[model samples]
Structures are given as structure tokens and as C-alpha cells.
Target chain A: MVEAHSKIISFASYIPENYVPIDDFAAPADMPSKLDLNRITGLEGHRRSKENEGTLELALQAATKCIERSKVDVADIDLVINCAVGSLCSELRSKLSPSLANLIAEKLGIKGAECFDVSNACSGMVTSLMIADSMIKTGQINYALIVAGEHITALVDEARTNNLWFKSKALASLTLGDGSGAYLIGKSELPNQLVFSEPFTLARFNKLCVGEASKNRPGPMMRTKAAQLQQGVMGNLGEFFIRSMKYMDLDWEAIDHVYSHPTSPRAVKKGAGIAENTVGKIKRLHNESQDIANTASTSHCMLLEKSVQLNQLKSGESVILVSFGSGVAMLAMHFYLPEGIEQWS
Target chain B: MVVVRAWKSSSEKTTNLLKTICNLTQNLLSENGISFDDIGVIIHAGVYRRNFRTEPAFATHIQGDLKLKCGPVTQESNHCFSFDVSDGSCSPYVALNVASHMLRIKPEKYCLITIGDERPNKQSNWPYQPITCVMLVALEGAGYQLTGTNFDSSAFDSSTYVEMIFDSAKSANVIGESSSAAQINSDNSKFSGDTNWLSGRHIHAFLSQFTEGTTNTHEIIDQSGKTVTATWV
Candidate 1:
């Protein structure tokens, strides 16, 4: 009914109540300055969902908050999509029916909406956004609920049992935490447009990072070639950023905020810095990801939610959201706050 | 509008699956006179390995392996966004629905879906053993039309295909074929005892309606113990 761009009507994010201070990490005694872990990874503490908490609960919690704040009638939600890294149902026996999206919609009491899940590793949320954006711009549905609940801490906890340091090659999975995020996107006019959303596949380096469950492990485990991943991100970050900004007709100065989806590793943080430098000075930086750690698919949305909570965004200001993940793929999108709209938590 | 072009592959390793997916997708596009530049998005659907490989989203490899290098004519616009839709056999159906809306959205001219997977070794309800199959579904206007789709969410049935369908008769109109051309559908229906029924039978059966394949349908009882026929045409 409005402009073709999908304007975010509401945002909500949640980190589990259980807190895991970096000091609590099961690092070896000689694990080289446990206190410096925060300095190295830009994380002081992170949250981890308890055993009783399933991925679906994390998603439901976040979605509840989003729908409450969105104030939109449940019947009006035309789509529900889950872009999480892992399955919400821990036990995916044989049946794959009743998708996560449908489950979420049912929980939220939103019927008659198309439902599905799109998994794209860390960049899944935005990728889902791109998909919803396409559908919305085409007049398929007005309101699309996109959410992701990640228990990446499961990967870290798995490593902690034995050889975590050796397996991750020294402090991998340090910045990962448990969290979920939700966004309600709808059509809006020009000044409130969702500018450019692009995802480019760089699969040559897909092997650098992978998530899987081994024969002995029942949950997701991440094995990464940390060095190689950093090298790849850094080598391509600057060039891609400049070209993207130029293509979007945006100046680094015009962007009121840069929500760089940091992966929580020191090398990645450095690469992020290099990425920012290549784009000149970002007007304001949303780096809460350091404290929250990396939440995989939900990281970018978490960053945006935190910015809204802190009132870092304003109406009509330019913002850039960037995500790079397991697919060795990168999604960059530009958007501005709608007129007269205030940040909502 | 429907399954204008299709390809199927079967393999054990993820690498082979990706290879098969890439080949099948490219073949479909080329056969349809579609270029890499014409596609704005690629939707991939399938489960990870038996254990569920979560990271490095497989679509990345599938997209990367395509090697869509920029041509001299257009360097800026050739890039297409690719992502994965994971849920099991139901993923391709959902991906196609998402693609339908996306294609109708201007700027997205074509949608390519690549699906393939092998049955996990330990699943008890698997009707077919060591089954792996791949299919490339490309949809564009003025082609075969996807009438609609339905899923028996009541439960998962190994012997039945009941998710998405292309009913030749249900479609409002047919381009150069008979009113009943080919209809392909998938769902977790009852898994008939036939080994061939588990993998790519829907594709073959649907194609048989128009081409040179045999038509075979099986009726198997579902989790509810009700007999439901899994058909191909």
C-alpha cells in the first residue's frame, strides 16, 4: 500500500538470562591471559541459554517482544520466516513437516501467512530480509516477520569438554553467545526506503569455516581455519565496501550508523577496522557486538536492535548493515529511518 | 511460471551433490535460453549431511562453483544473491513459492532452485536406502505453470510425495502441450516399499506424462495407518 521498500516497523532482540563471563570459560590454566580475552576478542561477557532452553524458546521469546511492540494485528502478518543457523527443534527425528516458520507463526497466533526458514550461516537474517524485501516489493504481503534464534554457545561448550584450545587453534568460539532477534518489515516511501540489499557468493573459501556435528558430538560444532578466514575477509573487505558504497551512491559520511556484523574474533575485529577505514569514517559505529559476542545469523539484527535501544538511530538518517558468513558470502544493505520515527525496543 | 526446465542428480558426497546441482542448474538455464545475467536470485534447498552441516551455508559453494565471472558487456549487474532453504524434502517446495513471489517482483527475472540429498543411514523410517537425488527447477513466464501445492503436515511419511505440485490440468492454461501435461508433487507421504519410489520418481513420473517414461504409482500407509497413494503424473 505504501512505497515498495520494506521499512522495518519494529525490532526486538534477546540474550538469555544466564550470563557466562569470560572468566568462566573453561580455558586451560595457562591459556595465556584469560583476562585479556576481552581485549583480544572485544568481549567482556556473553549470555548462554541453559539446557532447558530450546532454540525454539529463544526464537519465541524474541518474537513475542517484537510482535508486542509492533502493535500490528496478528492477522495482518503475511509472512513468518526463521533464518536461524540451527534447527529450533533439537530433535529432528524423521519428519520435516511443520516448518520452523509455521511453528513460530502458530506460537505468535499469526495465521494465513506464508512460512519458511532460510539458513545462510551468520548472514541468514539479512538474507531473509532480502527475500522478504523481494516479496514485499512485489506486493505479495505487507508485513513479514523475520526472526533467528542461535545457540552458538553450544559449539563453544562442545569445544570446552576437551581440546577446545587445540581444536579452534587457540581461543576460537570465544565471542559466540546465545541470542535471538526479530524484525517486522513493511513497505514504506522514499525517505524511508530500504536502499540496496546485495549478497555475493565467494565460495572459494567456504572450507575456511564450517559448522557440523561429528560422530561423537550430538550438537553443532564449528571448525575453523581462523587465519585463512581473516585473510579472506580482510583482502576483500575494503574493495567490496568502496564499490558497494559507490554503487549505492552513498558517502561514508552520509551514513549515520555502520552496523558491521563482527564475528567476535580479534583477527576479525582487526579486519573489521580495516573494512571501516576503507570506507572512510563511519558517522557513528554500532559495535555492541563486542559485548554480545557473535550470534551468527542474528548478529546483524542484534546490532540493529541494540542501536535502537540505545537511541543511536534517528529518523531520516542513513544506515548500512553488512554481514559476511559461512557461505563466504557478504550481504550489504543501505536504509534510512522513516520520517518522525523514534527508536523502539 | 512453473517447472520450465528441470535436471536431477544423485550422489553420496556433498561435493558430488554440489557438482550435480551446478551442472543441472546451468544446463536448465542454457536449455531455456536463459543467461546467468538473467537470474537475480538462486534458492537452494536440502538438509545438511546426516549430522546437519550448518556453516559455510552450502549455497555459497553451490553459487561459488557456478563461477559466474563478469563478462565484458556487463560487470556490475551479473551478481545474483543465493541462499539455502533447509527443511528436508519440503525445502524445494518452499523455495519455489518464495521464488514465485520474488520473480513477480520486478528486477528478479528468473529463479533457479537446486535440490539434492541422500537419506541418512540411521533413519528408521527411510523407505529408500542410500538415496540421493538432485533437481534444478527454473521458472519463467510463458512456460509450464505451477498450479499450486499442499502438504500433509499431519506427519512425515517416507513413501509419499505431497508438498508442491505442477498440475497440468489445474493450471489455467497450457502452452503447447495437452491440458494434462506433467504434474510433480512432494510431501512426507507414506513411503511405499519400492526403492525407486524414494528418489526422483515424482520427476520421472511427471515427465513420463509428456515424454517417454513409465507411469507408476504406489499406495502406502501413513503414520496414521491410512493408505495414501504417492503418484508421479
Candidate 2:
């Protein structure tokens, strides 16, 4: 049996320098303005990449910063995985997962590290962490690098073109943002900070959300509201929480913090209800910055970074990161803070 | 189970082809029961340019057309073609795996669509091979089966059979290009002088090994609407 003695060696995140206030971008005129964005989403502002910058660049920046903070060399990396949700191309044939790997290899001068991409929407980072942990435990890799970057603004239909949810879920567009986050995981003698407890999937509620019209057959369309609500409400959050707790052999009251995918205040509230928010320990962010909304695979990673940066977690404290995406996939994992890492002053 | 409709490709240039493909794909999905929003995730694989140019334009095109709220598109690289050549097995499988991971969807609830086009480049001296522009759609519906197995041919002496086909394709290009040049010179008969005598001799030698009733013959329909037949002999 493989045991996980894995911990996040270091983490880094990058948001573009350009700031896009909610009012500057084209949105519903009647919708709340910048003042309301700060009040609602708890976001004073969100970062937007300057023109001509792409997802790979954002990833590179975050990865480099992560390597620097982790005090590890890129050449030491045994594997590199991109958990990002956006690409520079529109055609299925032109997607850039492997190419990004090649670029990272060339830049880091790592000769033989296995590189690839993974997706699971908002939960992508945690899912990637699990895979990296497994690989490390199985001896498939020693040092793993996971990066996620999303440019949701490029994909949003500001025209409210075809989606009815755009009217009802206009808040989604406002809450989304563009950014990137990276993590380095490896075997260590130190006690693990991010202890991956278990992974439970509820795929039966798959039709919750959709985007990027198919290029072969259809023109464009959005996901049905029925699937979305089912995934949000009647879906498997309760089971996920129960299974995770069972795997960790802990009760709901034991968790000290919760970092969700930041879908919306409503989704977060409903998910919290699954565990009955028993300790009132659930904390949320990005309720205002819609630019990053449904950033798919990158949301969880980004949220985790923010939570850490905000000093919301402390040494020995256990936190739960729950993620859900359009496939209605939900994963709950338990992580303990590493020893010796001081809280942000 | 969702039945696959027609698989078509446009004859347009490869520039910004993703947009055109997305438009065409959307039309196809609308015609069917599926819609863009119904898609849980979009996995773009095997993206490569002739030269190194990294821009999210291809993914951006799809996002613009389909209004994808969230989904990661794969980076561009020559390996993109590996997804297709691997048949409907490997790349799509990887895409499904990643999509399930990212979209948090059940593997059974989503559909995987792959589209690609290889445009001819005229600058090279080699004869132009017709580019294959194919679009494949596989859904997570029930009552479907794929029956096939892949094994390494290197373990058998029959490996030479596959090598010969590749050699033939290369030699055919040379012969066709030289013949065209000869015809332009008004001396078509001179084209035979440029034939690769060494390769011809090797081909003949390679054929002799199969003459002892050791090889099998197979027949399949070619893309040209012809019942082409081939024998290892």
C-alpha cells in the first residue's frame, strides 16, 4: 500500500498587473458598480493581463515564482503538470497542453521530466495534487510542479449572447477573474502540511454547466439551469463530506477552515449546508470579481493561494478544500498546515 | 445513446481554423440534441504550428463562439497529431481523463469531440500529401463498443511490412515530383533516370522474403471511394 508523506513544498500566484474594475468592462448598466463589487464579492479589484499576454506566460510567471519561493530548482523537478483551463487556441486541434510542457522544459532546462496537463475545472489544483501525491508515493516521480492559469474574460459572452443564465447568473460573470497559481509537491522528512485525505466523485450530476460551443456541429449554447441547480443542491456534497471525513476518520466539527471553488455566495452557502457549517468555519472570497468565475480547473488552486496569503490558516490547523465543476464533479480533501511556516505578519 | 451524425471538414485555410470549426461544430450540435452549454468541458489537444508561435487565439476562438465559461485548452504542439493517429483511443481517453478531473463530471456524462486539419505547404520540394481534416465526436452514452487491440510489430519479422509502406509513400512522392518536372521540360521519358535504384533493389529484396506464403493479404476501402486491395506478398 502506498502512503502519502507528501506536502506542498511551496506555492506562488500571479495576477496580471492591469486592474479591471467591474464598471470599466461592459456589463449590465443596472448591475452594481465598482463600489458594490467590493461590498459583494469581497474583492476590491481583480487583475487582468495586458493585451498580447497569454495563458502560458501567466503560467510561466507563477511557476517561476513558485520555484523561487520553494527554494527548488526547475531542473530538480521530476514532473510538470499544467492544471490550467484556458489555451491560446480555439480549435480542438490547436489546444496547447503538451506544448506548454515543452516550453516549460526548455525554459527550466529540465531534460527528462515527464510533463502533461490535467483538467477538473474549479477543483483542478486539488485533483492535480492528488495525482502528484500518488505519483510521488508510487515512485513514478519525485518532484512535481502543478500550474493553473485562466483568462475567463476572453471566453465570457458579454453580449449576453445566447445564455439565459447570463441574465439570472449575471453575478457569475462579475465574480470571475483572470489569474494563475502554481504549487510544488515532493517527498519530505517534515510532517505534511497538505494532507490529502480522500477523493470522492459524484459524476451522476454531470449536466450542471457547459461552455465553448462545439466547432464541428453546433454554434453556441449554455448549460441548462436544471442541471446546474441539481448539481448545486440535490447533488453529492453531503456524500463527499461524509466520505472524506470517514477516510480521514474525523468528524465535521474537526475541520477548522473550508476553501471552496468560489462559484458564488449561494453555491458556497448550499455546499456549507451539507456539513451544516457546524463550526461556522467556512470562509469565502471572490464573490465580487466575476472575471474569474467558473475559471474551471484553476479556481480551487487560486482560492487556496488567496486563503494562505490572507493568513486564514495556521500551523496544525486542518482545512477542507471542496471543488465542483460543470461535470458536477465534487472532491473534498483534508490538509494540515505545515510546521514552522509562520503566519503572514 | 447519441448517434454520431455526419463528420465533415471545411476546405478553408488553416489560419483561425478553430473559429470556423467551432462555428461548424456549433451548427452540428444545435442540429443534434446537444448544445454548447450542455458540454461539461472542452479538451483541445494536439495543437502545433509550423513554427513556434504561442497564442491563445485558437482557444479564444472557441470561447468566443461557444462562450465557454470555464475549461482548459491544451497547449499547441506537434504531438497534437498523436491524438488522431492514435485512433479514437489514446488522446481522447486522455482528454476524457483530464476533463473529468477538471470539470468534476462523471466520465459517462460528457461527450468528447476532436477536430483537426493538416493544410498542404507548397514551399517544400516534396510532393504534397492530401491533408486529413477529420472531426470525431464520442459521447458517454450506453450501448457502444470498440473492438480493437494494438500490439508492437517490432517483435515480429513482419515489421518490414510496415516500413515498406512508409518507404513507398516517400518514394512515390519523389517519383511524382520528378515526373512533373520532366513533363514540364517536355522530356517525360527522362523521369525514369531519377528513380532511386537502391531503394528499388531493396524493395525487390524485401518482397522476396514474403514470397514463401508467409504474408497475409488484406482488403479495405480507401478514402478515394475505391475498394483497394493489398497483399503482404
Candidate 3:
């Protein structure tokens, strides 16, 4: 018998068709008129979620694509992990029980699969992957589907309709967009198919951002110390990147493509510079935020799916994913795109 | 094999959620001759949170409050990884499965998991009293070694369920509107549990049996008829 390694068999992402232009947002009287949302967020517009659509629906859409691409029977899937931070369902109500994972499995007609939900802000997908990878290596399960559907723009709506102080505090919410992503992970004997560095949380910066229900409305809201969060993440980039490389035992130049947290184009560009200064230059660092802005937890996979559709990624090439979430949860994953990558296109 | 070294819990409501978890964690670590630095991972599992709060994992707050090695992960420094597992009543078992695999790869390192839930705020309606439970699991330990865990999730069993509902008057997501279709009594495979409280009460029952040295296996079934069963020494 061969030792098992978790490999990404298939992956897909979903972005809503509705695009909302930045100009559509009316600046609150209290917001500094000079605060340039475009230049700061590096976003021209973002995807708007359809009415009555929520996390479960978006996740199912992406999960369907991922499963279809895998060519594997749904009955063979033994695990389901939902990593959506915004777990809204049923009239956009924040769901607390019957976890999004269980609900997703039910909707997909997947039976007898172990299911659960993970919340680590935007690093959720990668964090859930770590668990699935560990379980596979331990001979616990055969296949696991890691999924996330972030119905995140409710925070944007909350910030838009609220008062002055609320708008200022929730400014980062403006960059949020709705999206979903899914990865079908299964056992493999090949090397470099999937590898993860130990995830760390710099909880000292935990208070830099927060998301909760609206004080004066019926939906979600977010407040962020945007500058401070960026500074903290960028300041630690050198060490995080170096450690990730070391753990995966990859030469800096071995990486072909890099996908980061996708908070903003400026932040990704700056953080990439800091990482390169500490290590070496990346071959291609992807920042697909201009049209869709930050898609929260689904950002990296969404970018990966886009890269595939554009023919930018070649089969058997090494790609690395780096992510940092609001909990200050951080991790990096290195993997090789499986054969038949062009099929996803 | 990974084992449960020690456990502690609190439900007095003397303080907020994070503080309660940290207090229990501190006591569990001290009593078991462990330290904050000894922990390699922390997983918080529950359903409800204060203010419907999302973003930072509640475990991060606990790790920060306990002053664990909450530093950047680097070659020269020690660090602790923390995240949250939200599986309603099945969280502890799910977290246990994840931690078991993690500890198996990193021999001798320990993982601390905290489980609990609370109403978001005062204006919001709360269904049950808030309670927090902490468990220390590790590979090189002398306690009940976890042998295995299995999960059976087939359908959407709404017999027992809960979801956030907006109270127009309060303008908040509260637990008041959340409902459980029916109460579940213990049988052979599933453990009896309260519909209002989350995993803390189920854990309490499991601990009671463990204390009496009567049961070697425990099971938790969520409102969805999904069940996770774990056997120990």
C-alpha cells in the first residue's frame, strides 16, 4: 500500500453576473470627500450578488462545477468542508446551526459524508485544506471537498446606508464582492501535488478588523482599520514568505505563479515587493482584483479559476497560494496543477 | 495515538466568552503541567458568537488572551496556530478529527480545543445560557487515547436546528427565533442532548460517563440526524 497525499483533483469558482460600478456608491456626508475609493482599493467595480441568493446557493454552483470537472462520482466523496466566513442563508439570515457544510451536502445529494464548517475569515479555504490534507495522510478518508461561498457584500450595503462614523469605520467593506470557490481533494501517491506550511495566527492584530450585524439594519457590517491591517501584514511578509518556502522546501524561483490574499491590488503589489526583497522575485504574481475587487475567502481560488480560463497556467506547473485573514490567520500552500488543466478552460 | 490529557469548563457567566475560555484553558494547562508555549494549535468550535461577530476566529482571541506564542511563524521563533470549527453540535468531534491528524504528523505537540456558544448581545434574544469547555489533546499522553471517529451525515434533519433571525425592533440577529422541531433522547448510537445549548452540554454528558469509567465510546448527533462517534481507551 502506498502512503496517501491529498491532491487537488478539481477546482472551480463562481462570480455573480451583476457588476456594480464604484460610481454607484454615494459617499456619506461624513466620509472625507477626498478619500479616493478607486485609487485606494484599486477596484473599478465589483460583482453584486443576486437577490435571494446566499452562501449555500453560491457554494453549490461552484461545487457543482468542481465535481463535474473531477469526473468522480458524488458517492465517492467522503467529506465536505465549507469554509465560508459569511454563512448567510434563508433570506440572508446569518445561519448558526445545521452548518453550511451539512446543508451543502444535503443540497448536493451527497450522503453519509462527514461535514463541517470552518471560519478563519478569508484564509478559510486554505485552512480547511490543511485539515483535509492531514486527514488524508492519516488514512482517515478518501476524498474531501473544500468549499467556500462568501456572500460578503452585505457589509458594503451596511456601510453605504449607515451614518458618518459608521461609514468611516466600515470603509474597507467597500472593497468586498460576492463569490464562491471549491476544490475536490483526493488521495495521491505523487509528490508536489499538495503541501501546506503550518498555519499561524498573529492574534495581536485581531482587533484591527471585525465583522458583525448592523447596528441600525438587518444585515451584516464590517469595520476595519485598513491602514494598520495592511501595515501589519506587509511588515511580516518577509518572515511569512520565507518560512513558507522553507517548509515546502521550494526554491524561490521554483514557483511559477503566486496567488495572494487579494485584499487590494496595491497591498498585493507592496507585499510582493517585500517578499521578493527577503527572498527572490516571483515569476508571476496574480492580482485579479480590479474587476471583482476582494472576494474575501474565495479570492485565491477565483483567481486560480480565472488564470485557468485565460490559459495563463500550464499543466504540471508549480503554483503557490499565500493568504492572510482577519484573525491574522496566515498560511501558504504549494502545489502542481494536475494534468489536463486545459480541460478546465 | 492522540489522547485527551485534561479538560475544564465554565458557565457561570461571570465574564464574556473569550475571558471564560481563556480562564478554563489557563487552569487546564496549569493543572496538567502544561504551559501556553506547549500548545501547537488551538481550535474554537461552536455555533453562536457575540454580536453575530465574524472575521477573527474566536480562537485567536483566546490565544491572545492566554498570551500563548501568538507570534509570526518563522524559522527562529515558536508559534501557535489557531482557527475556528463551526459545526453546530458536532464541532468537538469534527475538531477532534482534525487535531488527531495534525498531532499525528507533529509528534509530541499538543492541540487545545475550546467549545461554546453565546447570544450576540443584550438586545438580542438568547435561547440558552452560555457555557465554555476546553480540552487538551496530544499524542504523547496517558489519558484516554482516542481510537477512532466516524461521521454519518445523510439528510437535512430539521428535527433540531437553529439559525439567526433578525428582530426588527432590536435591529439585530438574535437566537430568539431559532427553533428545534423536537427533543432528542439518547439511544445506542446518539447521545441525548438539549436543543437550546450547543456542544457544551453534550460534552458534559460524555465527561460524566468518562468520570464514572463506564463508557469507552461517545457520540454526538446534530439536529440533522448527522452523527459523529469517537471511541477511546
Find the candidate with the highest TM-score and give its number: 3
By DockQ, the best candidate is 3
Query: What digit string (tens of lDDT, one per residue) describes model 3 on residues A1-345?
Result: 355777888899997889888767634333567566777768788887788789888999999999998988999988899999878763757777867788788888788888888889999899888888877876778999999888988878778776645367778888888989999988887865899876778888888899887776676888999999888888778888888788778887768999998898888988889888988988999987787888888999989988987899878888889989997877888888877888774
- Candidate 3 ranges beyond 4 A from true positions: A26-31, A164-167, B72-74, B105-108, B158-160, B181-185, B188-191, B211-215
Write one digit per residue (lDDT tens) for candidate 2, span B189-209: 111111211111222222223
Q: Tell me candidate 3's TM-score on chain B.
A: 0.87
Cα RMSD of all models vs. native, in order, equals 9.3, 14.6, 2.2
| Model 1 whole-model lDDT (C-alpha atoms) | 0.61
Worst 10 residues of 2 chain A by lDDT: A89-98
What is the per-residue lDDT of model 3 for residues B31-138, given as tens digits with 9 covering 90 to 100?
878867778888888877888887788888888888788665567877778888877777888888778766754443689989887767888655566567899988
Largest lDDT belongs to which candidate? 3
Ranking by lDDT: 3, 1, 2
Backbone collision tally, model 3:
1
- The Cα local distance difference test for each model comes to 0.61, 0.45, 0.80
Model 1 residue A126 lDDT? 78
The DockQ scores of all candidates, in the order shown, are: 0.24, 0.04, 0.71
Residue B99 in model 3: shift from native, Å?
1.0
The 10-residue segment with the lowest total lDDT in model 3 chain A = A25-34
